[model samples]
Target: MDKLAELKQGLEETWHSLGEGWRQLRDRASEALTRFTPVNRSRNSLEDAHSPPALASNWGLLAGDLYEDGEQIIIRLEVPGMVKDDLDLEVRGDVLIVRGEKRVEQERGHGRYRVRQCTFGSFRRSFALPAPVIAEKAKARCGNGVLRIELPKEARARGRRIEVRSG
Candidate 1:
């Protein structure tokens, strides 16, 4: 029975080695897949949270939402880590343009960073209004890292009914 016992022990060790090899293969495959996958800024919020900043590109991505409430179109953007003075807003024709620059400050005495994810760069986001707005009367406010832009729709764009006249 000595030979049989030795054979059984050898088989157990081989099984464990095979299991480890499978685990390593799975981990390597998962990392390769993640590296190749393209991240969609609009759909994947969690990925954006952990993703490193787009340093290779000149322009950084800006996330925002546009909606219409009553007679006004409200646009809210997430512009964290920036001051109001760094932003510029303009209305040209039917397009509302927002331009801003985010500067990243690094102290000289600070220790090395293992992971830097905060994005810093110039970004421009332009939105086309659904209806004509009074450009001169537009109002914008930046508070708590959120930029709110309110544009009032033109009087003509508001639903108006014309009386039917019998010929």
Candidate 2:
């Protein structure tokens, strides 16, 4: 085989791997509550674990749940190692926006890191609400590595048909 053809084949294979990884991540986004960072083969093993790689994607699942129960909409997000002050929340139109930065805590004593699996940085996740909600009446709380929010669904207007008479 020619050298150019060999290089093209290798590039195509790499792209396929990247596409599959991204597809799996997106497909399981709603159900999985774990974070993932695909190792960049091009970079040396000594590089930073948090470096932005393939497709300029950072790492953080920020998994959460959104559901409606009767008159309210409930949202729960897994945000371990954080307090209420570390996160931010907002309601925009039919979407709920959650933003936060996860900073790595410093240890008391000096020690060299042997293993690192955590991804830290700013992340924003937006969820579309199934029903309208009253943003002013929303209440949220963060505790036990989880953030829970409840928004009272807006009262939907009832439908009424007007009778028409021929003149």
Candidate 3:
């Protein structure tokens, strides 16, 4: 009886140690992947190829949300470290493009100056309009480095209903 109990306790200890070792290995692997993945720089052609036209910028472009609400569409972008004057909004034909540049202050110290992360660049995002919108009536507001655009639906073309005539 004594030997059997000792063997059981020994097996349990080994199982717990193995579990801890496995967890450590998994954590190290996760850390390595996080370190290797490159951080977003700006709206690059490679990364923005899959996204919509309005979501091409490198900064807020990746973090913005596009919502459609029946008669109106709203686009809210999270653009930190940028001023309202630095952004330019343009609409050409059926496409809307948002462009902006974010500048970072230079470091004063002159020692080693190693930069581990970089989050500054110019970005341009274009969105294809599903339906015609009132470009002239569009309104934009910028507050706390976030740009919000409200596009009102064109009254002339709001899913028109046609009557069926019998021949």
Candidate 4:
């Protein structure tokens, strides 16, 4: 009876520990992530290649940062294994929407993946702007697997600079 009781208690403790860990992770990440799905990009003549069968674990995250700098909002997002042509960007209301596809580049024919850690799929990430922006004047540049977007502020959205003088 004692052995059975101890085993049950140990199992309960382990279960609770795992649950707590998962809860903490969810609490930290549940709001920061956006939906990611697979997109099939049509191959050009230069990119003609075969793709491996999709596995169950064919999903990943696109991490990014959005901050205000002086008179503009700058957003930088991690987009490895992708190009400028692969991405699509747009802004509606106060939200900035970015869509892109990361395709699997086949280096050789008839090869098996011994280790597939990197994710290849389509993903969209959105950010809420702190202030209204001049969407027409926005500038975007991409390099080194990072997408940088500079959104200029609208005329009314730019805050007035005030100087305090000691009386």
Top candidate by TM-score:
4
Instruction: Using TM-score, rank the candidates from best to worst.
Output: 4, 2, 1, 3
> Which runs of model 3 end up more than 4 angstroms from their true locations?
1-61, 160-167
**Worst window of 10 by summed lDDT in candidate 2:** 38-47
How well does each candidate superpose onto the true structure, as a TM-score?
A: 0.59, 0.61, 0.55, 0.67
Q: Write the residue-wise lDDT of candidate 3 on 9-112 in tens digits.
A: 99999999999999997765542221112234443422332434332222322356667766877888777777788789987777778877666433434343
- lDDT accuracy of residue 62 in candidate 3: 33
Model 4 per-residue lDDT tens digits across residues 38-117: 46544431132343444323556667888896689999988887889999999999999998887766456565555555
lDDT of each structure? 0.69, 0.73, 0.64, 0.77
| Model 1 worst lDDT run, 10 consecutive residues | 31-40
Model 4 steric clash pairs = none
Which residue pairs collide, candidate 1? none
Candidate 4 worst ten-residue window by lDDT: 43-52
| Local lDDT at 148 for model 3 | 92
| Candidate 2 C-alpha lDDT tens digits along 1-167 | 69999999999999999999999987877553433333333443322344434423345567788877778899999998989998899999999988776765433334444444566556677888888889999999999999999999877722245899999
Which residue pairs clash within candidate 2? none
For candidate 2, what is the TM-score?
0.61
lDDT of 3 at 39: 35
Stretch of 10 with least lDDT, candidate 3: 30-39
Q: What residue runs in model 4 are displaced by over 4 Å at the alpha carbon?
A: 1-34, 41-56, 106-111, 163-167
